[model samples]
Target: MRRVHKALWWASWCWPGCDNQAMLVEKNVPLQSFNSFGILAKALSMLRVRSDADVDALLSNPSLKAVPKFVLGGGSNIVLTGDVKALVLKVEIMGKQLVGETAKAWIVEAGAGENWHELVRWTLESGYPGLENLALIPGTVGATPVQNIGAYGVELQDRFDSLDAIDLVSGQHFTLSAAQCAFGYRDSVFKHQSIDGEGGKPGFGLAGRALITRVRFSLPKNFKPILGYADIEKKMAQSGWNAAAGAPSAMQIFEWICEIRQAKLPDPKVIGNAGSFFKNPTVSLEQCADIIQREPKIVHYPLVDGTVKLAAGWLIDACGWKGKSIGKAGVYERQALVLVNRGDRANPVTGGEVMTLAKAIQTSVYERFGIMLEPEPVVV
Candidate 1:
């Protein structure tokens, strides 16, 4: 028995050629609806792939040729509206390996399937020092680089070294640099790939077929803390953690961030939410100067380019959308920016509800600040 199982396990990894039905679960799996923002959708087909070989075989399943494909990691950032039409690939792989760590820096790779918070904990325990400020971020490591997730004054591009992704169509895998990702404010090549529905770069067909296998982060071996965000600084002071003296290390920063997140964002398990639903709008420095001249309390974060990033949440709250609940969906009273589904729809509000809420928030923000806040997720 051991011989047969061992041989099969070995084959699953080494062969990369298995087109077997026995390895995959076919149909009848109901995904849990308690995703961070709690909208539920039934998967047309879902597979938890662990190996490159599995990825190859699934892509080759000729029976599924007509269906579109999407990978789900942690399900932390997405808001599933209704029944999905695509084959949802749930990556079940996990583990961590230090591909490279030098005296000056370190590189850590994690499975696309791993949880963001879990990975953050592992890094803290392992003494890595850069991801602290990014603690409590939703989604998986594989998904993180795509959004270039950022918070509390630090962005992913600040630490992103590189990543590996597999092309879904031709089964070709490739590496990407920070530059190739074209990291804008919560945007990347993967999310922004033009759609003829797929990657249509005029002459390119395989322009957008990529599966993020793993992501690597570069971190300083030496202790370097970033303390620009006011909340982080205030919390550091609150926790009696200092940035200068053998003070707030990366682990402490991670904990502080986690604490702050817990206090601010509603637990998705109890309520359905996708965290912050809108991107902070960036405006010209001149526009910012003009606005602040009127409302001196307007908070802004400066960008590398002379422009400034405005807080979308504050703007939404200012528009009086906070505490507004409609049917099963509502905006959290404390956090005006997040859209929450209070309960399952009986006569559930249509996808139109989400749209209406989005439009109202967008219009109000634009009117108040003269800057438009864009939705961060792919609304399909």
Candidate 2:
């Protein structure tokens, strides 16, 4: 195993066949600190990819070419069931810059490994206010498009420009437009497995085969803060700002979102959690009406498309899971949608325990509401 110092990286990349040109492959890397859950796990082999060139070099290496790989980002949205057997490609790619601008929008691009919330802040601080509504999301920029992440009245697809990714199998660098990504609620092409088409043509899905390198967001020139959610409205009322008189600034909305989230969700640093444990289940109007008839106080939001999105937290709370524990995993007291690690770092909750609690919650919610809650985190 060849190891090159950080200072020598540029020199090694510049000079081919250098003794230190081999990609750094760390062995038996502990992953407790890597994942938000703080579950104990180890990656047998790991590589920190700083750039697409590093990915190309990794693929060209005969020893690593055939090994299965996991592209890890902030590790905030995953649960480790056990030690990872595949080679973990930890994305450390870092950069954020104003790429370009059009008449209506300012285009900003950030490296995949750049922190998601930091990017939102940087964009706002840089005089781009479109991303302020998505403040405090925990993950990498790469994971944003993959998950179609959204908050308050804005979704990533609303501001997405395009993204750069590397095809893991062909080692081909490609760019995807928003349409090509096929973004949906908490899903994109990246979340599904590739389908085999006739004549060996790729059908749909890029899961496990594409590594996102950079994400580009289009911030509108005429920025309007997204304040449709009840939480934001409550914040406005508390602040004595009348919506009819004037709207809050993007910065104010950002701060309000930060405060709202802080009050409701536990900090992952203090309490191990993967943010919202489940996706808010969407149902048709008739179905929602039926459920509403049984449970008159069910919290739901009607979408423009006539579908109703129910609050998963309310369902869980109604099922008596809030602040409840199963083994080392527990539902967050403030927000029942969030599952937390009730154990300390030295005795952290296992992935099995988290899933067990989640399953129990799902069963309870389903029995009560007739809606099965889907988990948001990817279980590894």
The top-ranked prediction according to lDDT is 2
**Candidate 2 lDDT, 1-380, residue by residue in tens:** 87855322331232245356656678788899999988988897888989888888888777677899999999989999999989899998999999999999999999999999999998888899898888898989999999999888899999999999999988899999999999999999999888765576666999889999999999999987777788888989999999576878888888999999999999999999999989999999999999999999999999999999999889999999999999999999899989999999899999999999999998998887889999999999
Which candidate leads the pack in TM-score?
Answer: 2
- lDDT for each candidate structure: 0.74, 0.90
**Residue-level lDDT tens digits of model 1 in 1-380:** 33442112212322234443355533434455525655555675666778776777666656553467777777776666666667777776777778997778889888887888788889889878788888888777888887879888778898888888788776787888888888877877877544554455443222236778888888888877877777787887887765356666687788888898898888876766778889888889899899889878887888788889888888888778898865666888878878887666434334446667888778887787777788876554
Q: Clashes in model 2: which pairs?
A: none
Report per-prediction Cα RMSD to one decimal. 5.1, 3.4
Q: Which stretches of candidate 1 lie over 4 Å from their true place?
A: 1-21, 32-34, 194-208, 242-246, 344-351
> Over 4 Å off in model 2, which ranges?
1-19, 196-203, 243-245
* Per-candidate clashes, comma-separated: 2, 0
**RMSD score of candidate 1 (Å):** 5.1
lDDT for model 1: 0.74
Query: In model 1, how large is the Cα lDDT of residue 359?
Result: 81
